[model samples]
Target: MTETAATNEQISATLVLPYLNHAVRMYEQKYASRADIDAAMRFGCGYPKGPLTVLDELGLDTVHDQLAARYAETGDNLHKPADLLTALVGEGRTGKSDGRGFYTYANGEVIADDETPSADDQPQLRHDIKKVGVVGTGTMASGIVQVFAQAGYDVVFVGRGEDKIAGVIGGITKGLDKLIEKGRSDEATKEAVLGRLTGATTREALADVDIVVEAIAEDLDLKLELFRDFDRIIKQGAILATTTSSLPITQLADATSRPESVIGMHFFNPATVMKLVEVVTAPATGADVNETTLALCAKVGKVAVSCADRSGFIVNALLFPYLNDACLLAESGVELSVIDDAIKAEAGFPMGPFQLLDVVGNDVSLAIQKELFAEFKEPGFAPAASLEKVVADGHLGRKTKKGFHDYS
Candidate 1:
């Protein structure tokens, strides 16, 4: 049947009306699955979910009316609706109700299956972790200590000296206090978290912990020595994990007799805030070790992705190349602000390369770039001579307050 002039006129009011209407029609006609429709919407338009899902959440008539208004204004083909959406709107068969329109709703409510796990299903892993041990007194170590302590696990924070251990504990306490002040946590929670931490001045303090995470200075030899010592001290069957970002997990595993127990649990910077935890598995790492590490990440409210024991792993492997490219741009003597502005505007980056370098610390970026260049020997990964010069000048980003831009 041909559409009425009124229907055609109504189509002129919406911007994305035609696209959404087409999707609805296709879905109703059983042309594709809801998953495919959702995928198309998310990937095609960058909407968080499909039109149908959005309709269900926003109420169908609301979206339909909004589209109709946009169509009235634009008079573009994009505003026209597919036959399916027209029919559903005409019949008042909006989604999440009346058993119609992309999805069925029971008793005027969106039906949710309790038996099956949904996309957001986060199944908790039962970790029998009573005590946790962490080696290192730097930012990463303090963050690790916070994670365990907050989870009600007794944490043994180890450092080479009493002063370092004291500093780590102090940092952890300050972090917890910040959380409480921000209302993200309560005073009682802060107390409990602080009560769980025990700073140790030696490796022997890790003996009783169920899991030991090495977060020491990123020196391969130093890490290997620490792992060997941990092998002799930590209880057998206990999980041995590392927070090395670039080092190979297999080489670290070789430092211990029980290589099967060793794995890399690389936490991103400002570990307490970043959600990603790359669970690096070595050739010698046992299946149980992998599972336990994944479980531990979940316990700490992190999303873990398992990867092979390669330098830089997934995110960094992709991330650093882009960063290196940015450095190259800066090396061309493009004003720092110009380079930053162009990339931020054109590429939609959150921060310009130089700005991000400052935030990440120039020294850290130089070290990582050196490691990447050594491994790949690619021109793209080459450390920008400009960056090296800046670091040598002691302009080590935000920490030094004088990197790409002067903080002072």
Candidate 2:
């Protein structure tokens, strides 16, 4: 049982072990790149390093023996070591200290490029999209618009009226100004980027764009309505994508005649900073559609991992459950900072669960947990009682300027 004075080993076994096991099994199955898996954990969970890298650093042989001992003691299937990990250990390629494990290492440092997939290994190309249409005037829409325009794609964004449209543009400009102040950009580059953006208020304006991404409200009906409208409005042969974090892609695709053309491109918060984007595929999504979505992500400089259109995709699937458990610990009388500090200092996460919950919006976290519980029906996924109270209190997050912690 978890206790107030839990040691690092206890914390690691409880908080980090399940994720490590999942990562190893997934990597063995070739679900994604070793690089992508590590990158996903880092970008998705705010971890200092990915699980594979952590294994390599800790020494695969040590991890193998640890699992072996635990499995022998408890006979729990979850404690079983992954075949790949065990096989590597059998080869004596323990980890970085000895030069190899999941990654190649020399002089105790990982040769990162050794694990990077090469250009020749790239995914198939689909459409050569030159223009992108962004639906909505909110933070996500603006950030996505900036990302496309900054990547030299002509961007057309939709808003309700002149003022709302202006506000979106204004937000983008303010961000550009920040870049200029930091010497990361200049007036000339900002002007060129701004020149590539065309703001409109109607669906007709989006017709010619090769890729149209809907980034509006999270409501399913609203998304369905927008998808139906785009099905008729967006040009034939264009790729239709959604920025949805949790909804099913097939549900949206059902509204369109070209189910094969629909996909999900979930960009993380402040899309410009986060390096990972989940490239989700419904069963009906065409092979070329998947290829093009990955291609588009590469073009815009985002690391994309393709996954089934399941709840939480890859990163969120592994991350949110851990965050939920942390909440349960907090509600059971563990000091908030203790859990946060143990996670950050002992477990190597960048933020405590509480801090992350505050940033992620306790409401958003609860919604995702609810979706996870419904999808998997796992008891561990049931939303924390305290988290439910926080959301019910109406402190959504930084959006509402309060949540687990009061915003200053």
lDDT of 2 at 243: 89
Candidate 1 lDDT over residue span 251-367, tens digit each: 889989999989889887677777667778899998877877877777877767666776566545434555665565455444567666655554344666688889888888888
Local error of candidate 2 at residue 333 (angstroms): 3.4
Cα lDDT listed for each candidate: 0.70, 0.84
| lDDT score, candidate 2, position 156 | 94
Candidate 2: segments with Cα more than 4 A from true spot = 1-4, 28-30, 64-100, 104-116, 400-402
TM-score versus the correct structure, for each prediction? 0.68, 0.88
Instruction: Give candidate 2's whole-model lDDT.
Output: 0.84
Model 1 TM-score, all chains together: 0.68
